[model samples]
Target: MEQRIQSYDALFELMPEMGAQKELLGCECAQPEYCFTHYLEPGYKEEDILVEICQSVTEKKQDSGQITFKVFLKVSKAACIFYKGSYNTLHKSYAMLLQYIEENGYEICGSIRESYIEGVWNKESEQEWLTEIQIPVGTGSLTQCIC
Candidate 1:
């Protein structure tokens, strides 16, 4: 597994659906206490700290109470560990990614972004689900992580 750095602008598009009220919608690397509101505005690049959002969705029928939701995250530049196993094996993949980060001299600047690339409602096939574990890094920032 390898991590790649990428700049994203459309991340804000998902905020409303996720029910984020007062939180700064950018990366979690910023100090959680101080909410940076304008950092994500157009052309404000200096404050672009590494950010990630863990996203998940659920659906249910009106009669039955069996609701299902898939959870994942999206992050800036970090390594990725793809797994092909049951959902119970997620922890092992996480530990492996952490080890890789430590070995490569990178720190987790903030919280994790879990992106649910595939889910039940989105697809008829339930055999596959895609997730991304994004970890912040020291390089490649529009601005920088101050907290």
Candidate 2:
């Protein structure tokens, strides 16, 4: 987590204007998230974690040579969860979402993205932090069963 902040600091050093709101490539809002971590997985390996710490920049100027960027498009159907609380308890939320995805018969097609909506900057406590988790799905679309 500290590393991600350090990267954000590095990004800010390269582009100070990032302090202002701007739209990111894959994000829907103009307000930038503190950081986005994508977990690329059909299933995560117990021995290793696949995580990418990154943020979206608006224009070419904000993008420096030191940074590498990628643009991801939205998927046809996504299973989303809005979580509020400390980062430590995030695993519980992930469990809920993953279970939902599995039960609904959705095959994850892209990276699982976590975008911070609010946190340390605005709220005093970690309990107030809000995040959105989006998992892209495919395989003939979702069919929710009440069984």
**lDDT over C-alpha atoms for residue 54 of model 1:** 29
* Tens digits of lDDT, candidate 1, 1-147: 011114333434433333332122222222222111112132213244444332322322132121112232334465666554344455677788888888887765555444445433355554575545545554434344322
Clashing pairs in 2: none
Superposition TM-score, candidate 2 onto the true structure: 0.64
**TM-score for each model:** 0.41, 0.64
- Where model 2 places Cα greater than 4 Å from the true spot, the runs are 1-35, 45-48, 61-66, 140-147
| Backbone Cα, N, C clashes tallied per candidate | 9, 0
For candidate 2, write residues 87-130 as lDDT tens digits: 76777888999998889776776777787777766799988999
> Each model's C-alpha lDDT?
0.41, 0.59
Candidate 2 weakest lDDT stretch, 10 residues: 1-10
Q: Which ten residues in a row have the lowest lDDT in candidate 1?
A: 35-44
Off by over 4 Å in 1: 1-76, 123-126, 139-147
